[model samples]
Target: MHKIIVTGLTGFVGTNLKKYLSSYEIESLSVRYIPNQKIEINADAIIHLAGKAHDLKKVSRPNDYYEANFELTKQIFDSFLKSKATVFIFMSTVKAVADKVDGILTEDTVPNPKTHYGIAKQQAEEYVLGRKLPEGKRVYILRPCMIHGPENKGNLNLLYQLVAKGLPWPLAAFQNKRSFLSIENLCFLIKNLIENKMVVSGVYNCADDEVLSTNELVQIISLALKRKSRSIAVPKSIISTIAKIGDIIRFPLNSETIQKLTENYEVSNKKIKTALEIEKLPHTAQYGLERTIKSFINK
Candidate 1:
């Protein structure tokens, strides 16, 4: 049996990946307690998904991100290299490339991580890349854009909440293209990377077939929830001023939140698609987002 070990199994992406690949002999285990090599010694492959994600609340320490995202990954990668595991997949983030991409983000972009979270993941990627790999054993550092799936509570949820309340989407004036990866497509790429030994070791950015603007996202959410999307073109200046105030009031509609929603974070999936020999992602970006919005709205 081809057994696979996945860390951070309880997270949104890990949980969804498990549900998607239920037929595979997969085990979700914690890496903090169990030593890395001890757990991975006998496994066929390891998917390093456990990490301290970016703290939106700004409550976590700087070392926390480095240790959890970078150090823990280093431990696992070292173990996988020594073990029988033929493949290792580390779930990184597109943020490792840049905080604000001037144009479309692809695998070729030089990394300039602005946040501690991005820097940590980038360091982890560098650690793996610097190593001399054993023959036939490959490492993949995957940088995926915002991932959405069942029970996910992030920007998608915020959008869902706005649309579900039948409130006017007042921030449609800031139209920008952003890329999103569905949990389904991510699992597909991971499965292929594990089963196929021919895949070369390096970083790959994953995303759905197309990019969508915030307005388009609202439209999709509205359609999915069977509600009318009432959008108002609130002046960007006024909205920005309100968002600035929101920062002091601890309102959810702060400048940072607004920028994240409106900013362009496009990533290219060309490398992944070429590797999989597929013309397009199996599931449409809106399909996954729509499903998730409806799932949480009904809940």
Candidate 2:
């Protein structure tokens, strides 16, 4: 059995990955940002998932992102270069490339991160690519967008709650499509990368093949709950004004949250799909999303 050492084992992605890769011998490694800290690798592959996620509330310090995302990644990657681990997978976010992608985001997109979280992750990606790997070692930097799955809690959960309470979605006026990554697809890609030596080492964006609008997502949530989907097409201007007020009053519908809800951030998984020699990911966007919504209802 291939032994895999995974960081951030307690996190959403890490927890799901552990369950998904049940055939592999998995070892959980706890990691935190400490200056000059070094890691010891004893497994055939290492999946680095431990890092500071983007702080939606804006309460995190700027240096905290650098320390945890960039510095910790640098330390662990340096260890991988020296150790016998044949595969090193770094979990990065699509935000590392661009917070707001104009068109479909591809592997060729140049990075221009807006937030500290994004910039820190971008730095880590550069560091990982800057080093030279041994003949037998392979490194893969995966940039996943808005991952969701069972037992996951985030904006998707918040949306599920709104639908569960029979509250009409108020942002239907704003039409936008966003890309999402299913945890199952992510785990499948990582397992393939670990087992398939023909796959090249480089940056690859991970996302479902299809993009869905917020309205469609609400419908999916409703379907999962066996309820009719309701949406109010209030004027965009009125919603913008309300969101501005929300920013000042600390309500849930602030400018940041509003932008997140109505953003056109589509990511392309073409490179990864071609590398894995597959026509499409195992799950469709609707299938993965419905599964996530059902999990929320079951809880």
Best by lDDT: 2
TM-score of 2: 0.97
**CA-lDDT, candidates in order:** 0.86, 0.92
TM-scores of the models, in the given order? 0.95, 0.97
Task: State each model's C-alpha RMSD to the native.
Answer: 1.8, 1.2
Give candidate 1 misplaced runs (Cα > 4 Å): 33-40
> For model 1, what is the C-alpha lDDT against the true structure?
0.86
lDDT of 2 by residue, 1-299 (tens): 38999999999999889998999899999999888888899999999999999987789999999999999999999999988899999999999999898989999998999999999999999999999889989999999999988778688977888899999999998889899998999999998998899999999999998999999999999999999999999899999999999989978888888898899999999999999899988999899898888888778
Model 1, span 1-299: residue lDDT tens: 37888999989888888887787888876876333445455688788899998888799999888888888888888888989888889999998989998789999999999999999999999999999999978889899999887778777777778888888999978889999988898988887777666767889999998999999999998898888889999999999899999989978799888988899888899997788677987799988988888778678
TM-score of 1: 0.95
Give the poorly placed runs of model 2, Cα more than 4 Å off: none
